[model samples]
Target: MPAAAHDLRTPLTVVLGQAELLERRLARDPSAPVDPAGTSASRARRDGCETS
Candidate 1:
């Protein structure tokens, strides 16, 4: 169980970091349309980093 949690940690860290960044950007430019579900904005930020 610990190993599984550990394995998931890194990816979750990356996701959380991306989410934090997106939250900032969204706070700064909150005009961007976002899905009501919230994950869309986070995925958009992650995708932005992936492209770059």
Candidate 2:
């Protein structure tokens, strides 16, 4: 299972980075539209969608 976990590390890091990036952007531009707001509720719903 370590290999599987290791394989996921890169993608999980990307997820966290993207979340951080979204947070930074949202902080800079509060009024900007970011899909469903990236709130906990919205994030839970958006977790499944593939990003570019």
Candidate 3:
């Protein structure tokens, strides 16, 4: 139905937008250093997973 399609499309569009943003962030700057383990977002994800 049209309503169901609309419901699914909105979230999919948001997810695609966020993925694009993340891809841009991760593309990185050549002059900056990259640390895989030290980001606060990674720390939060690790902590959240451990608690669950």
Candidate 4:
């Protein structure tokens, strides 16, 4: 794979993994409160590191 694609895929993988975990947790307990800063993707977005 190209370096650019790899770079994009890495963060996307992390985001997708976090999303799946959240989905499972929410399924078990829909009343659970979700923290905006709970995932790395959220932190990246807050820190302006996320391009998309």
In terms of lDDT, which candidate is strongest?
Answer: 4
Error of 4 at 28 (Å): 0.2
Predicted candidate 1 versus true structure: per-residue lDDT over 10-37, tens digit per residue: 6766776777777778877767776575
Model 2 segments more than 4 A misplaced? 33-52
Worst 10 residues of 2 by lDDT: 43-52
lDDT of 3 by residue, 1-52 (tens): 9888777767756655565566457657565566667444445445542221
Model 3 pairs whose backbones collide: none
- Please identify which of the two predictions, 1 or 3, would achieve the higher TM-score against the true structure: 1
- Model 4 CA deviation exceeding 4 Å by range: 30-52
CA lDDT, candidate 1, residue 36: 73
Which 10-residue window of candidate 3 scores lowest in summed lDDT?
43-52
Error of 4 at 24 (Å): 0.2
Report the Cα lDDT for residue 23, model 4. Answer: 62
TM-score of 2: 0.53
Predicted candidate 2 versus true structure: per-residue lDDT over 1-52, tens digit per residue: 9788677766766776677677777779968776655554346337843333
* Consecutive 10-residue window with the lowest summed lDDT within model 1: 43-52
Q: Name every residue pair that clashes in candidate 2.
A: none
Give the clashing pairs for model 1: none
lDDT of 2: 0.62
Query: Candidate 1 vs. truth: CA RMSD?
Result: 8.4
